[model samples]
Target: MEKEDLKLLQQKVTKLRAEGKYKETIEACYHLLKSGKECNDFKSILTAHINHAASYYCIGDTEEAFNSIEAYVEVCSRFGDEADLLHQYNVLFLLYEYNKDFAKAKATLENCIGLGKKLEKYNIVSNGYSNISHVLMEEGNYGAALEAGQKGLEASKLHKPASPILELRVKLNIAKAYLELNHFHASKALINEMIHDPILESFIREKSQCYHLQGSWYRKQKIFKEAFDSLTVAKELVESYRDLYLLKSIQEERCQLCEQMEDVQLGYRVQKEYISLLNEINKQELALTALKLEIKHSMSDFKRKANTDFLTGIFNRSYLETTSKEWLEQASVKDENIVCILFDIDNFKIINDQYGHLFGDEVIKQVSNACSKTMKENELFARYGGDEFVVLVRGASLESGKKRAEEMRGIIGNVKIEMGGNSVSITSSMGVTDNLDGKVRSFQELFHHADLGLYEAKKSGKNNVCVKLADKE
Candidate 1:
């Protein structure tokens, strides 16, 4: 293949892997390897091997993944890019960590950091420090993790354009280290700082880490309710992002929480769920190997269904929770505003009781459609629950959020669903909040305030929009 063609093909493999089509990605990589070999394209061939290894790892084929990585290393040793070598070493670190080879993982990360500094790739150096911290933490060396985390933070600051995500990640690792060391006050202070950080909100994986650490801190303090809530949010985020590795840790924490609460049945149920989730993840990974060899099933539908709500044909709560954080983070960095609007159908239960669920479903569909129509560009509308819907307006001011909420309320209130030769109209109550200034408030805090406003709206009268501002703290 030509050079441009080879580049496009490489991108295709990457895209496929990113989309979670591991089988398809592996197949593409195989084809690329064959083509590269025929064309004597050593670069393409080496890249194919690396891509194949990543895809294999994703599907739980550890042996093949390791073999491919080895092959990639050999190629890099002969004629590889310095940056590519750095990346491969990082990947090797993960592989070693997965196999419980903490010593090797730590060494590999150190090598990565050295190479990155030599090459002036400060980002890589920063990331290497972060990875080392994580490995050390896994090895039950909190002091070392804290040391590495601080180094990572300092290294990250050396870059021309600071990476908020990386900075937050290092801080979170340090916070975890603090928590593990039983430095409760120190950890709590750091956690509070990050929880309200707009920059941290963008990175869901790191945000989840923050929450997990917060849960740990709360648990240590004997604050059971706060601990459970934080852990639950962490669980939700990991599940949404499909971070199986992190999910396992969260599950273990939850099991502990259940035990501490003395809820044997709940503990049993949590343990069962953990097992089921693990099995499901393993099954999917194994299936990818089968798919590469035998089946060619498409996963697009499965992905769509996972992120979509069946009833309203809109984004589900999981999608909202995951994506909205990213949007908020971006808006924060740009010094723009993000408006969150929470609304639900008024007297939805009564409608269901009187008109039956079928009619109630129609009402929901109609209201959802109306609300969706009122959304502007870059806005997200999601079915929060049975009758609750949330609209996220990116780059919008507090006033704009309230205006949008009123517009949506009008749209929903005017919506009429024809049911059994009867015209039934329903109204909606809405709450709006925005992050305009630098005043820090977490997504949970924003949501809580909006919910309170919604309650106030409902109390005064339904079919109205209420505005709430973030407290100046």
Candidate 2:
């Protein structure tokens, strides 16, 4: 091959490498090495393979990088060169770490460490230990990282040209491992050491991550003010990157703060309005209830006027007879006991003769009140005719209902009515009959039996209760 052709190939390789096209640069390097008879030798060939593998590693093509590294190692073994073997180990360790192959990465580092010690290359040992510690820490091997970081720190300090960058990186990683292990004080001490170092000032992103870690630690400590300050600083440093999740976090915090402030300002106003609205609702409810009650009372008075006898103030004959039939039919269906009692103003003609009709009406009203007063809640007291009254008792036997009738008869006989300034007493004769026992086909049958009893009560004596005896078939 011609020297000019090789030189042109070299120029192309240099250009590709400068442009960070490592894969293309490696291909160009290989072409140049193969074309040059002088350059196509053991050492040059191995260098080309290493360059190719490094590019593959940088591009995250680890499979190709591993294949290239294996080929490079075979070539080195063929040449039997141990000079730059530690560099090869370093590259392989990086590739393994990138691939998340922690075991292989650790093993490569161990081999690098041994060779570096033998060669007395403090720089190599320090960098190798740092990388090992980094992988261990990433893999959550805190104890291993701590040990490796300590050894790396010592090696870094002993290097002729001390690498503060490597030292800081190792210390930071060890601090992170301490934090992971919940050794806060040790972690904080290591962090403080790194913070004091002048080199940390140049690494903006690393510094931001450190602040974020500190903020989190403070938050866990319940030191809100310190945490807020640290987080504020961290956010300012990273805001230019426009990280959506972190921006959302900051915005959510701000939203909560704003809501709290608004709540503080408006809480009392809302409470006052709530109380006022409640009072207004109660007032409206009371007014509505009173209006409902007034309407009910007016309707009840209208119903009474329509259905009641004016003189006696009891239900008129028509209403009484209609209601009695409905009660009897319902009671018969339910197989319930029921009784009907009829009462008449005894010797009504004599009363009219003794006093005026007005006085007679007064006597009727007094008698009606006496009967109504004696009636139970389930009993209906109604004036059935001019001088007759009726009572319907639900769920009562004939005997018990006769007793109730007698009680009413006695009450009426004792009550005095004002008749032209003449206080006069009135007596009523009552008759009772069981409607259920008869299973009366009609309300007329109940009234017929009760009327017979009434006639007998007047015949035997005035103001008495008489039960109608069931007739033989």
lDDT by candidate, in order shown:
0.83, 0.73
Model 1 weakest lDDT span, ten residues long: 294-303
Prediction 2 global C-alpha lDDT: 0.73
Global Cα RMSD, each model: 27.1, 39.5
TM-score of every prediction relative to native? 0.58, 0.45
Q: Candidate 1 has which clashing residue pairs, if any?
A: none
- Give the residue spans of candidate 1 off by over 4 A: 263-473
Instruction: State the number of backbone clashes in model 2.
Output: 0
lDDT of 2 by residue, 169-192 (tens): 667667777777788899888766
lDDT of 1 by residue, 154-192 (tens): 998987687777677788888888889988888899999
